[model samples]
Target: MSSKPLLLLTPALAVIGLLFGGGLALALLQSVGYLAALGQTTLTLDAYRQLLSDPVFGRSLLLTLWIAVASTAVSTLLALMAALTLRRSFRARPVATFIFQSNLPIPHLVGAIGILLLFSQSGFLARLSHLLGLIQQPADFPALVFDPYGLGIMLEYIWKS
Candidate 1:
């Protein structure tokens, strides 16, 4: 009921307005071509229009949408199956639960590096393959790290999620 409550809220409100509001405003301005540093002062929808009109852009957008949908569907299915199995009785239930959840606590960067170490062409798998005569050299192994289909990324997603 006193001025103290208003004073206490003022600084918090100002900080939120300065940080969150400023960030949103900056993003909106830059998205509409208002980046002074980049010399993009004109505000126009030409970029958006071009992206929509270009056939290559359209194909890329469709492919992105397809990958998103497929990844989501598969992730959901796999999660459901895991959930069902975890709730049922099994001898190695503890081990299964541990394996399913171990990735949860891991940082995303660590998980990504783990995936790279295991799956990259010059990774442990590739080196082992070479030693086992599966491939003459690590470089000769198929490029799985940055392949067009991004299988390594998908595997990382599945393992982490």
Candidate 2:
């Protein structure tokens, strides 16, 4: 509303615009195979056609469905439970409420990486499983990284936002 506040917000807004807008432009270019350094500047739909014909891409579609459903269920359940828990009066209700929403301040990238490190095929859980003899090799572990069920991605979504 004022010149002072406008001046204060200008730099932050500029940085955010540059980062988000530039990344989006780059992604749009790459989606059509326009990476000049890689000599892939053909800008064709061949990549999309390849994905359509690949079984793994089909499986990825299924995995995306799984991630969406699981993340929605988990976040909704957590929100409902938190609301119920905070409904009643208690000495520590304020603290509990803040704790319930603590994840809101976390960056999405950090939360996603945290989930990956904790749950991916070669992640903490995998190493723990190996140490405990629960799995014989890395391949023996469940496909939580790029799984049909998207276990890692679901956890990331639920934890991040």
Question: How well does candidate 1 match the true structure, expressed as C-alpha RMSD?
Answer: 4.9
Estimate, for each residue in 29-67, the C-alpha lDDT of model 2 and write its tens digit: 999889998887788988889889999888878877877
Could you tell me how far off, in angstroms, the CA of residue 159 lies in candidate 1 after the best superposition? 0.7
The best candidate in terms of TM-score: 1
Give lDDT for model 2.
0.84
lDDT tens digits, residue span 1-161, model 1: 68999899999999998999999999988877798998889998877887889999987776677656766778889999999999999999999999998889898788789989988998999999999999999988887778766667667777778
**Which residue pairs clash within candidate 2?**
none
lDDT per model, in order?
Answer: 0.84, 0.84
Query: Which portions of model 2 miss their true places by more than 4 Å?
Result: 1-51, 120-148
